[model samples]
Every structure is written in structure tokens, then in C-alpha cells.
Target: MRLSERLRGKRILITGVTGFVGEALLHRILADLPDTTVVALVRPKGSLSGRSRMEQVLNKKIFESSRNAAGGTTELLEQRIDVVEGDLSTIPGLPTGMDIVIHCAGDVSFDPPIDEAFRTNVLGTQQLLEKIEASSPDTHYVHVSTAYVSGRRRGAIPEGPVDHVVDWRTEAKWGQAMRDRVEETSRSPGILSKLRKEAEREHRRAGPITAAQDAERRRNEWVQKKLVEAGGERARSLGWTDVYTFTKAMGERVVEEFAQRMSVTVARPSIIESALETPHPGWIEGFKMADPLILAYGRGELPEFPASPDAIMDVVPVDHVVNAILAAAAESPEKGKPAYYHMASGARNPFTYAKVYEYIREYFDENPFDMSERGAVRLATWRFPGGERVERILAMSERAHKIAEYVVTHAPRGERIRKIAREVDQLQRRLEFLRRYMDLYRPYVEAELLFTDDRLMELYHRLEEADKEDFPFDTGIVDWRHYMVEVHCPNVTESMRKYDVIRRRRGRSAPTVAKELPESGEILAAFDMDGTLLSSNVIETYLWLRMPELDRTERVREIGTMLRKVPGFIRAERRDRGAFLRSVYRRYAGADLEELENIVDSVLAKHVLERVSAAALRQVRAHRAAGHRTVLITGAIRPLTRPLEPLFDEIVAAELATDDRGRCTGYLSGPPLVGESRAAWLIRYAGQHGFDLTKSYAYADSHSDLPMLEAVGRPVAVSPDVHLWRRARKGRWPVEEWKTSSAANRLAIPFADELPAERTS
Candidate 1:
């Protein structure tokens, strides 16, 4: 009999109907076997009602063709699918008289807390088994499990029951104990008091409490850390990579407990990806195991991957896995003896890491993801330098990331630049997370996990020719090269394209010129002072200059204050640079404004002017000669720009607020003109002074000046950063390199702070 013919008249209880596998199976069953009853268990998401959440799933594109063929209406779908509003963990029992129970839902997170993983994977499976025994004792149970339950083993993985070291009941008791401890410790007055006392002592030593909410946060953080450590250590001891797998193994053991009472089939699929043939090829939902890495590579964000070139990575098409699952469910195994099928491709059709790398290169080379207005990015050539090399690279990357973070934290504050720095920090942190993920999946990806699929192949052969066409489970028929290049790659790129994440990375073609330059010549020429005219940052130079004057006691106190702020400073910059810049400038409070101006003038004469970029200086002179209104725009305080103030017709920069005594109050009188803020300021200033912005010229060297560059008709980049360089190329903007290292070296200024050696500009 055909697969669909056999499925006809069956009442199936399907869990995880919103998941990739469950959704695909539902579509298959409803489209192929119209007579079958599909009862889907959908958990209410957040504030969404259960039926509302089910409607959301039904609206997915994967269900489009199925829905269209089956009456093509929501009412028809409502009639066909019985949506149950429930969770597997808490559900008392499923609907009675169900012919088949397909348990597809479980926690798939790699690092879920031990108790959470067990509660969802093990306890949930146990609950389902009991429900089946209570409501429908004769119903067949089809449990979808991952092949990685083999857990860090080598050679050919067998198609049979898994024999784990820990008893399922013992594991369950341990999980309960952990939960009890967590709840007990949370309410314990002694523990909470100790944590609060320690936090209070640390706060007293640090500084004045800036916010009350922060006071209780550290104590909670410390307590949570201890809980996580305890769970993580226990997970590791179970010989599994994470709590997810260990609990999944326990889940299988729970299934074994009911093997004698009913017919049970465990379908283990290895690294299931997008569908190959069924329900439309290359159809995938959400980011799966390797999708992030693939997307990152397409965007040129991923530079290196950690894996051995020749490692056999077992991957299976979603359709083929689903086919195996359905076929396994149909099989009549001997009573009290459950059937096991390994739904994988490695044993019959294998794709090595090297082959995958080659396929990706060829795919991108032929059909590069069109970032549209954003200039195209080339995917890096993946290098698989073995395990040791990967660790070495990670160590180097970590050190470099730390150094970059340090520079961003201490660098002179420019709101725009600070915002960009924060983005850089976030990207670096993501890279770090990816590196850790790579470590977690390294053994799985790099190992020779040759799964034997003899029983799966047998089931395929037994299917009639018509059934074979509709439900194909044979991986031997898949063309590895074609599937990787033409099928999988395009699917991933298409999905990411819809996401719009690829184009948002600093590349967009310049907008068309809207208005011509004013012919009568009321042109504004905006010059970015710090990196444009002045080779060094004035604020940083001033800080170094002032460092030597502090006494030992004052120096020690200041050092402690700065050290205590390092973590918050980095995080603040990442979250919001404007706020970070404001916080940074606030440190100058109580210093005499006039004294700082005098110091700025002396510094400009002795150190700043000579280091001014010769190329920039010439351009400024030319603008002045042309009768254009010259403006010096910098994030530095007004006093720091005083020495160079005479050269410009008007100065636009951050101003320090002064107290009644004329000392710095360390607050800005207005918004600091940095990054996009600079552009806003320029537009306002131009409107007030009757200067035509369309006729104006702007100069800057960083990506933060993107707004200013886009604001004016003629924008120039001088020794620009990487992001700006890419933007400039795409926008056809002028770029000039300036050299001022020798001029900077000519100064004999003494500095007390042991600053990192400066990079020559």
C-alpha cells in the first residue's frame, strides 16, 4: 500500500507543530492524505491566544501550496487541523482514541540549564508516554530524536536503542533536587544576607552610588553565577556536550520504559537541513545549526571556521528525514521490540568539510548575494587548520578583541565615533560568541560519525513505486555537489536577503544629487578638526599632559576611579555613545575653564599645530581663498579649539558648561556635534547663516562622519577607516591620505600616563 493510503483514516497527535519538522510533516499529511486527522499541539506565545498562534503557523509560506490545494481557505484549514492549546510539560493528557502520537517537540538549545533541559526533554516525553498509555494504549508512538545522542563517540553509529550511563529515574530525581535547591537558596535569608553584605562592602570601596537599582543587581548576579556553574559542571560529568543532549539521552531512556507496553519507533536524524524534494526543495524555517555561519560567510563577516578538512559531517535533507520518520511509524515491529532507524546521509552519501567549503565558494562565486544599493562583499576563503590551530587562532582573536575594547574605552570621546566603536565592540563580542559555538560543535562536525541506515534503506525499498515518488527516503539519490551549491546555498541567501541584515553593513550607493551648488557663492566648508586637520586628538593629548601634575594620592585615587568604571564605560559606549561621551566629559568637572583654555593654547603652539595634516591645511587655505565660509567642527571642548579658532570664520564644537566660579561643570550646553549629530548641526548652522549646503564641502576620515559626508555636495575622506573606505568606494567619494607623524614627533611634551604606543598617521 502507498504511504498516504496507509496514513488515511489515522488520527495523529502531533506536538511541536510550529517547529520545522512538525510543520513539514503536517503539510505532507494534510496535502497527501486528505482523510487523515492532524491534531496539532500549539503553545500560546507570549500574549498571543492559542488559536491566534496556530493561525500564525498556518500562515507560513511552507503551508501555502498545501492550503491552496486543500480548499484554499482559512476555514478549510480550521476544519482540517484540530489545534490544542497546551504545553507538553504541563498537559494532563492528549485527545482520546488517537491512532498515532508523534512527539516532535523538545528543548534544542545547546546550553539550557540542566533542570530546564530535563524538564522539557525527559519529563515532557514521560508525560506524553503516560498520556498515551492512559488515553490510547494501542496507539503507535513515533519519537523524533537527534543522532548526536551517541554523544562524542567515533566510528559507525548503530541504528538501535541508546544505552546511557545514567538511569532515567535517577536523572529525574537529580533534576528535581537541583530545582529544589535553587528555590531553597533563593529564599534563604542567610545566603541573601551574606551576598548583600559582600555587595555593600564592595560598593563602599568603589565610589558613591549613582543609581539605586544597581545596588541589588550585583548580589543577584553573583547568586545566579553560582547556580549556573553547578548545573554546567553536572552536565559535563554526564559525558554529553551539553544539557540538551544529556537530557535527550534521558528522554530516550524514558521511551524504553514504555517499549514493552506498545509499539515505539525512534527516528534519529543527523544535522537536518532544508528540504531537498518534498513540500518544495530548499524550504527551511528559521536559522538552524549551521545557518548562522553560512549567513555570516555570505556577508564576509566570518573569516575563519574551525574544523578538519576531511571530517565526515553527516547531514540529511529535512524531507528525507521526515520520509524516514513516516516510514518508521508505518512499520509493524515485533511486539515489545521497538524499531530504530538512523535517518542520515553520511554512511551512504557523504560531504566532507573540504567539499562543503569548495561548494560554498563556487556557489557564491557564481551567484553572489546582491546587497543591492550596498556594495557586494566577497566571501573569505575558509581555512581548516585542525583543532590545535583553531584554539591558537581563538586565543589570538580574543587578545586582539580585548585590545580593541580597551582602545574604545579609553579613546577620546567623539559621540559619532563612540557610537561606531560601540558597534565594533558588539560585532567583536558576536565573533567571540561564534568562536565559542564553534568550539561546542567542533567535535560533532569534525568527527567521523558514520551512521548506519540499513533499516531506513530497507523501508525505502519496501515502498511501492508511487509511494517512493511521494515519500523518498533514499539519500543515495541526492547529488551532494548540486544540493550544496544550487539548493542549500540559495535558500540560505534568500532567507537572509528577506531579513535585510546583509545590506545594513555600511554599503549603500550615494543618493542622487538633488540641488546644484549656489552659483553666487555662499558655500560652507566644514572641516573635521581632530583627525582631519590635527593629526592627534586634542582631548587625549590634554589628558596625557595633565596626568604628570597629579600627586601620588590624587593619582592613586583617579586610577582607582577609572579602573572601576572600565566595564560600565565599555558597555555604555556599545549601548549609546552619546550617553557614554557625556559621562566621559563629566569627569572634567571642577577644573578651571580658563586654565584649560590657557593649557590648550600652549599645547596648540607647542604640539598641536605642527602635527596638523599638511594636505588638510592646504585644502582649508584653498577654501578660504575661494571665499567659502570655513567652519572647524570637532567634538573637543571650545577651549581646546581656541588656538585654531582664529583660522576659521566660525567654530562649531562641544562646549563645557561653567559654574558661578567659572570652573568646568562638565556638562554640555548643547548636543555634541559628532557623527550624525554633526550633520544635523551643519544643516541648522547653514540655515541660520544663509549658507547653501548643496554648495558646501565636508572633510572627514572615519565612518562616523557618514552623515556629514552625505550632507554636503563634495565630501572627502582623508586616511579613512575601513567602513568609510567601503562606503566611499560605493558612493564614488574622493579619498586622500595625509601624513603627519614626523610633525607629531617634533614635539618634546612630557607625559606621565603610560599610554599604549600610538599608531603613525
Candidate 2:
């Protein structure tokens, strides 16, 4: 489609420039078209906040692909791309004299209120129109709209403006969803409340589940909760599922109202999925509910889902949406009637829901992660009398009620299937227990929503037609089938890799992380809790090292080991009825803080010799020699106290609680010092005594420490984790990598038997 002509030297402005779809459009425009200038209008923010999400979007190919589907990459387009802060609701002043203005900004809500849809979509368009009119520039405006404007049309809805009467059928179908949302909201005070309730209730049922399950359970406990959450019912009725589109319908109407006098074109695409064509294929990001659901189902996350295998699910790639939008805008006549572009088709290319499932399943087979299979006997779900799959699913639902019936009547790790049953039942019970006592965010996943993707074909074909030379569109060069399987799949995995930690950052100020700690009448040299001294991961600690002799097994595990104990650890839990736990509870009920400290000190002084990083310790003593007060301001607990004590003047381990007698009774008396809390304490200690945190230096390995890291005058992250690493890169924090055990570190090790000479932290 001759995209070369329209894109030549065009200056375009885009709203929602940082949004999922907007980013795609921006990327496409930037990468494909030469001499094109794209200006982005983003919602503003304060300083010291998360770096522009645009960076995250731009950096990742998955994000880039998604953005490409809507548009091309601004960075690659070789055009001057300017990001201007603004929102759709209010049109902030834009740079004057733009050749093409794509108002891709609108309230993209799933179930927006009629008034809000009018205000943000319609009124927002009105505001943009007014702004453009006032400027009186030779700008061709392209408004991104949705294909759902059919408003509940039963048959295949065509593209273009039609005076189709909006009757009771449309209103009734859409109205049901709103009513359901209202009903759901009425049940719970808030969204979190509902999720928590569902989680709590699900926590009681028998099944292997994640946090989402518990949340679903809590929400489902109330029958009406599902019905009230907007698009569930209405989505299915319209042959296009999900609430997002329903709200978008209102947006389309708004565009129609405001596009009359403007040089506008409306691009209506349905269920804009990942990129079909662009720099890459199937490049998707954002771990939406879909991924979790799929992963869970694959890992037996849910007992069953109510869905029709035969239901048609059509999705257009992001680039097609972008292609149609760009070409239509380029083809727009002066003062056009909002050039309507339907971005759906089945004319020649037919991608079915069943085929999609097959493709996804095959992709999983080839690009498998370290997903563990059910380890034992298969979980035996309810056996339905009817042979049909639907009947079986329904039967399982009924049986799920009695999920906990066997918990009181089973052995640990029974049969594999039984184990699953036990696990789900136990998890649900634990969830219930926690919900009854702990402060938790409740999440409710509404059920009973029928979602569809009927007009997807019509939209795609229209977009394909727009791609023809008459209108002209080019989605760069992307392979759809392979892209989805290989490209997008890996992108999702990588983003979620190591819990979504892109990279770790090392900050400046290595010397600030002191070896010698501060004590009374001593120069303090403190090491950061996470990175400089100990490894960044605590979970890895327990996993790699043997649990303390006492903490060998859950039965005998010490409440507080080397690390300072949290308040909750000290409190006796009554969830278990086992005598073994009860006996331990009695032992922990009355513990002396001083005695506990002594126990931890002995372990730190002897057993846990491997915990200290020798090179870091050597650096500590050098500070002491240099007359700096060496202090160990760590998040470590008593027993897990490190090996480099003598180098420091005093060790400020995480604070612990004490009994009246001060013997090691086992429970913590107070809060543990860690992260920001630890920072706060350090600030107070320095202010009251004679320390200057700002002038002093700090070291760590986690990005979560960004707040505390900044508080210190010098922030250094050695061997940083992903978050910290990213910050270090962005904030330009200096990083140093060194071995923990060095020959010069001999003087730093307080104990004779330190971590093996060759061992490194």
C-alpha cells in the first residue's frame, strides 16, 4: 500500500502517547515514516517518580510491537518526537502548526459512566476540536475510535456512518452490564474489598490456586458481585466480549459529534490484540489477567472455566489498527466526514478462536519455561453423570463446594490428585484464617459475563482495504503466525522473568558502605543491608544454606534466626491444631530479648561464618584505620548476625523485642529494621548522635531501596538486583563489582572460621 507518500515529512501529534495502543502508533510512525515528526501528549507527573513508562515501552520489542501495531516507533522513525504533558479531558496547549494531528487520546474505560463517556470522549473531542479550530492550522485530524459503535447489532455490523436506529435491543443488551456493575459495586464498598472477600472465600475452597483465586472466591461468595461488574453480560450479548469496548462505544459517539467540522477520520478496530505485523510479531506486554489465567489453567490453577470452545474469538493485530488509522488520515479530504475506517475482516484471511488456541498451545510446547507439572496422583475432579464437557464443568463447580470435606480426613501429600485437593483446601483455609485476622486487599473477578468478537472480521477487512494503494498503509514487515508463537511468547516470559526485574542498578559511593560500624566513641562505617554486605536475596539464603539447626524443619525452625525478627514472627499463631506446633508456641510465648541476642551472636560469631563478604569487610577496617566510625546498620536478625563484627565499633542489627527476664525466649519484642524503616532509624540515630546520612554513604542491591538510596548523600549498589540496577542506570549511580573474600580482608573477619577462603558473597 503506498505508505511512502503520505508519511513524507509529516508532522503529527498523538494523545495517549504512552498508553498501550498509543505507544504502538507512536513507534510505527517513528520507525516507518521518514521526516515525520510525532508529538506525544502524556499525563504529567511529579519528580522522583517512576521514569516515563514510555522508556519501558520503547525499550521492549514486545511493547514496541504492540505500539507498532497502532503506529510505528518514534525513536526509529528518525523524526523529531516531542512528548508534551496533557490529558484528554483537558486540552493543554499544544505546539502550533502541526501537519497531521492524531487525537488518539480518550477515556479508555471498560465500563465508564454514560456521563463520564460523554464528558471524556464526546466533550474531550469537543475540546480538541475547539483547540484545533482556534489554531486554524492546515492539520488533518485522525481520531481513533472503536468498532463497537454498532451498539449491540446482532448481525455482522458494517463499517461507516449509518443512521441505524438505536432501539430497546441495543439499550437492553448494554444496560444489563451496567446494571450488573451497579449491583456488584453496591455489594462491596470498593473493588479491593470485593477482591479480598473473594480471596478469603476462595481460600476456603479446595484447589491449587494463586492470590487471584482467593480474590475470585471472595468476590464470588456474593452471587450478585459477578452480575454488577459492567461488561460481563452485555459483552457476550453483542458478539464482542469485555467491558473495555462497551465504554469505547460511547467514545465513538463522541467522535461522531465532534468530527463534523474537523479534517477527521475515525479508525474503528475490534479487540486490538498483539501486533500482527510490524518490527516484530505477537509482541505483547503487560501481564494481564489472561496470562495468569492461562498459566494457572496449564498448571491446574483453576478447577474449571465456563466458556464455549466453539465461540468465535477474533482479534486484530496492533499494526493493522495503526495501518488503518495512518492511511485513513493520509487519505482524508478537506473537512472530511470523520473518514470511517472499519479495521476488521474475514474476506480472505480467517483466524479462528480454535486455531488461536492451537497456535498458543503449540507455542507453549516449543517454548516451554520451567513450569512444573502436577507431581503426584492427578486431582480427581467431580465426575458428571452427563458425558458432555459443559455438564462436567458444571459438576465440578458443585463439587467445589465440598472442597474442604476431605481436609480433615486426609494424610499429608496423599495421592497426587488428593494432594492437589488437600493443597487447594489448605490454601483456602489459610486464606480464610488470614482474612479473618490480617489486613489484606480483596479482589473480585466477576463471572457471568458473556464476551464476543463478532465484528472483528468486518473491521479487519476494512483495514486491509485501507492498506490498498487507494488509501495506502504499510505495517512495516511482520509475520503474524510465527510472530505470535515465537516473538510475543518470549517477550511475555522475559518481562515476567525474575518477577519482572528488567535489570539491576549499581549506585555511586562504594566507600560509603563502610566495613567498620559505629558504636559509642567509635568512627562508624556501615555496609548496606542488602547488597554491600549480604546477598540481595533473603529467600536464596534459606534455600542455599541449611535452615538454622533449630529451623531445620517447620516443626523446630527458629522464629528469629540471624536476621532480626518481625513482630508477627514473635506472636503465637493459633491456625494449627497440631500438638507439635502448640508445644513450640509455648516455648516461643515467653522469650528473653537479650538471651535471644546472645544466641544469634553465638551463631553469627561461629556457625554462619560464610555470611560475611571478606573484601567488603577489608574495606570496613580500612575505613576504621582512616578514622571512620565503622557501623553495621543491617537488616539481619540476631542468630544470622554476620562474621565481621570486630571491624565495626558497634553493630546495629534489626531491633528485637525482649521478655522481662531477657533470656532467649524466641519471639521478637518489636519491629525489624529493614529498607526505608531502617533508613528512618539511621536518620534518627545520625541526627541524635553524630552521623550525617546525606554526607555519609550507603550501599544496596535492590531497586526498592531507591527511596532510601536517594536519602543518603551517596548511594551505591554493588551486585544490584534488577530494580536497583535500572535506577543506577537511569540516575547514573556508579557500580563496583568485587570479590567478598580478599587476602587483605583477613583482619576484617572477627571469627577464626570465616566463610571458606575461596567463597564469595
lDDT of 1 by residue, 1-761 (tens): 88877887888889988888988888788767788888888888899966787788777776776667765647646668787888877775578888888899998877665677778899989988998899988889999988888876778889987656688888777875776687577558776676566544333211123112234575456445555555557766876666677788889988987988888888889888988987787888877887777777777776777778888768789988877778777775654898888888888888888888888888878877666665677788877877777678778878877887667644654444546665766678667766767766876776767889998888889999988887888888889888888888888778677667534542343332223333345898898876778776543554543544466687668767876887897666444445766887888788877766655554445466777877667777777777888899887777767767667998987888999999778798887776667888899988998988877888887666777878898888776655565567667777677667573674354343333233111
Per-residue lDDT over 1-761 for candidate 2, one digit per residue giving the tens place of the 0 to 100 score: 44656577777888877666777777676566745777776666564122264454566654454345445554433335666666666667777877778877775654444334445565566677677667745678777777655554444555566443334234534454455565456456587576665543322111123334546555544444344233445544543334445445644555565565667676776556666546455555454324443343233333333333333333456767776677666665556466666665332244443454566566656654443242322221322222245335444644663555445332222134344544555556544432321211011121111223233333334544434533223322334457557755556555544442322211123233434443333233456644467433332333222222233354134424423433232231111112222223234444444534444455334433454576666666566667666666654444345455666676776433455566444444454444455567667777787776656656665433444566677677666644345456556665555344433233232221333443212
TM-score winner among the candidates?
1
TM-score of each: 0.66, 0.50
Off by over 4 Å in 2: 48-79, 107-122, 162-243, 285-305, 333-336, 346-348, 372-483, 497-761
Best by lDDT: 1
lDDT of 1: 0.74
- Worst lDDT run of 10 residues, candidate 2, spans 439-448
For each candidate, C-alpha RMSD in Å? Answer: 11.3, 13.9
